[model samples]
Target: MAADPVVSVDAVSKVFATRAGPVHALRDVSFSVPRGHTLGLVGESGSGKSTIARLVLGLERPTTGAVRFESVDLSAAGRAARKRMRRRMQMVFQDPYSSLLPHLTVLSNVVEPLRLHGIGTVAQRRERATQMLVRVGIGAASAGFYPRQFSGGQQQRIAIARALVLEPEFLVCDEPTSSLDVSVQAQILGLLQGLQRDLGLTCLFVSHNLAVIERMATEVVVMCGGRVVESASTEELFAHPAHPYTRRLLAAVLPLEGDAPPLPADDWDPASLDDDEREVVRISPGHYLRA
Candidate 1:
């Protein structure tokens, strides 16, 4: 039998009430994250990638449709139920500096989640936190150190440790490596990939960096104007992008030689194409495109 999806988003829509009118943030957004797989959500700023993460986390409710986890609709779940669901899902934010508390020691930071969930005794929590820190490549000797004492990459690893302390099955990584140097970014991505494999975690990776997405995602979803313009497996998406937006994003990624000119902004415009050209084309099984 096929493994059940860990998370499901069904025709969900999000709208903000503005002075001018209702501003639609997400429109008919739909997808499923299969068990132990990674799904990458890619788009420029204001494309609603973060919004989807928030919606899934119960930080915001959808204006229409539902978000379900294993057939339980998150939008309709009670507070206690939602709280319980959170133990299965956790988040790693974009900025490591902001995510970690200045006054808290690394041990405290990692144990905070356990404390909040009322899991284990104090001694057990500390031991588990220490083990987690080591698992994420931070030494146990550094547990007494503050967030400021570590480099950007180490801080991010601490953040990852904190998120993983609960042994969550699904993780929402919102630009987790966007702020790091190229080398550090690679390290963090590799660490994440390793952890996911070891723990059988499902990830929804949200980023605007197509190259990074190429490295991390098993499947890719291209978003624009709060809608999914294209979806495909990573290899198929890169090899045969069907949507004009996807093509534009792929083109924007700097070549390995680092000498290619930056892609022009006009390349992202869907309006430039006629209706016939605007439709997403299917280049292969599980690959799609939008003009």
Candidate 2:
């Protein structure tokens, strides 16, 4: 997560009513996913990353602000209108095992959205689903098998296939690789990046993992306690994290085996930098360490 680069401001908030009372969810969160760009929303559990996913998908409306898709105000749209808009956007949830229908066959699961949307004739829908499955590396022979038959990675591939079966303009991936083995994680990510490139997908990729976000997102919006703590292009955010929380996140990153953070050259002095930025010691021109 990157810091708010422009100006400082006081925070507003969002709450939900329940029998227990109002529970705070989000605070003055704002950012946009440009056409064909991936907006990474990274935060710890209960930080409202998934809440933003639901809001953007029109499954939940923001209490104070609006969630727009292709200039359509989803928060204000009618049910019928939202249904129509849903065809152009799709979501892949964290758990591939649960996100997909266990009872349905892989082919049927992918075809469900097309059937619901009345997308095409039965034959055409089956063809589309098959094509998607093939693209995601699931063969036509495995299409008749139920979800329980596939490995977690395979199940996720099927889930991604289902999400893309509609040829969606926007893709919302909510921790799509968190539950897999390390090797499988890379495979899934590579698959997603390849798909995103080929499809020109505008994506909202949510994850608590900064490494994954760095690999996937074009721009990033860092959320904490339901508030957007920082927003910036991926390079800018990782190279120059401005907020204290953002810096903490960077520090928390575990370096890969045989890799370590590079030390500063020691030629530069703290007196050379701006007063506001002096709190963090410069590790390099674009890197910092909280003093």
Candidate 3:
């Protein structure tokens, strides 16, 4: 009797075969993004955060388990079904410069998905793209400019416009603001927050910055070593971090002037943890911690 999640990753694991051996990119990861909410995925490099993004988008098949979108199992969907599912989901990558084609004009870049999906007439597509650009704070006059002509923030705005023009119900934002200046990042974050609120979008926002996650996410999933170390509502997780890794991560957040540095790593060592501590333990309602 409950509505299905917009996106769901269930017991998913990804192992990439390399020359040396199989690299386990993800390990039995499970999470869900409900409609009209943002699920923040935070972790350091090599934490398998990006792998989760790829799995949800069906860009990579899981070695084990499933990724479902709109109650459709993406890994098992046929080509046509997968394509149809893709139309309802979109992604915003970290680097805007590389995401937008250098040769295409800004307007063309934004409308590219519409044209590819055959969503509307040429005129209609143009009109829609123009409106989206304006919504992201880019004026209609600059729509003709090339990606290189814009600053880093502007390029990211263009990328956001492109991703949202399709009006997708789910958005996977992979460090979408990490490349911009602090001021620009704030603007982009504000824009995303506004867009999500107005459009009732469900988002999976990936970033390493806890501060940013605190600002944007309704729920947070903290990952480490290809596994989710902690999952909770933003407020609860920040207030009470049960996992040593989670505590270490929070300690590492840069502080203001005169604030002390994070405690040393020797204080909390994963190598010393027991097996039960390594498993996800429910701390309270809607909160889980890896001991």
Candidate 4:
């Protein structure tokens, strides 16, 4: 039998009460991240990708369904149990510059997580942080420098070091390279892939770039207006997209590819998220990264 999933989002739905009204960010969206496998979330700006990431990480509770980490329902998990779970799971946000402490040095940033979790002694945390930074190509000598002193790629490396210092089993990366320079994007992705291989990590990777998703994920979930239009192995989905929305997405990203059929003008309207039902689900308010 297949091994149990490391992370499972079971029929989860999230609605936010905004000044305008209730916005349904996720509508019965569900998927699982198998051990050592990366599940990619793909869609345009407001398709519920980031919302799913927050829900999976337990940073945000689903308005209506359950999020289970290693089969433990987060909604039902006790305070202490949830705290323990936090140490085992971590997130790599889209903007490393904003995520990392501007005032803390590189080493301090990486060591902060260890310190907060009480994972090791001062010396041990320093050693651990140094090793992680080195693994991500940051030398110990540069650890004392603040976030502004490093390049964008280097800042991201430090952010990653911070996340991995905990040695977590599950990682949630939401558009991790979206803000990096093009050449640097590949380097960072390579580092993540190598680290994931070495650590046997299960990951939930969210991105709008189809090419990146195709490279990093074994499976892909295509979301359209708060609903999963297609979920399949990377190869199968790219080779044969069953949903109309998925086809449009593939065509937009890889226009030259023959598999993505040409679109009929009336097939999809960018303005609306209606699929015969005409249900309009706006993204949650204040979620700058509109899922």
Give per-model TM-scores: 0.92, 0.85, 0.94, 0.90
Query: For candidate 4, lDDT tens digit of each residue in 1-291?
Result: 026899998888899999999898888777788888998899999999999988887889988889999889998898889889999999999999999999888999999999998988999999999999999999999989999998999989999999999999999999999999989999999999999999998899999988889889998888878877667788877776666677677767644446554444237664455433433232322111112
Clashing residue pairs in candidate 2 (N, C-alpha, C atoms within 3 angstroms): none
Off by over 4 Å in 3: 1-3, 256-266, 270-277
Question: What order do you get sorting by TM-score, best first?
Answer: 3, 1, 4, 2
Tell me the tens digit of each residue's lDDT in model 2 across 128-175: 999999999999999999999999999999999999998888888999
Residue 108 displacement (Å), model 4:
0.3
Q: Ten consecutive residues with minimal summed lDDT in candidate 4?
A: 282-291
Single out the weakest 10-residue window by summed lDDT for candidate 2: 1-10
Backbone clash tally for model 3? Answer: 0
Window of ten residues with lowest summed lDDT in model 3: 269-278
Q: List the residue pairs that clash in candidate 3.
A: none
RMSD of each: 3.0, 7.2, 2.5, 6.1
TM-score between candidate 4 and the true structure = 0.90
Clashing pairs in 4: 48-291
Q: Candidate 4, which segments miss by more than 4 Å at Cα?
A: 254-266, 270-291
Clashing pairs in 1: 242-289, 243-289, 243-290, 280-289
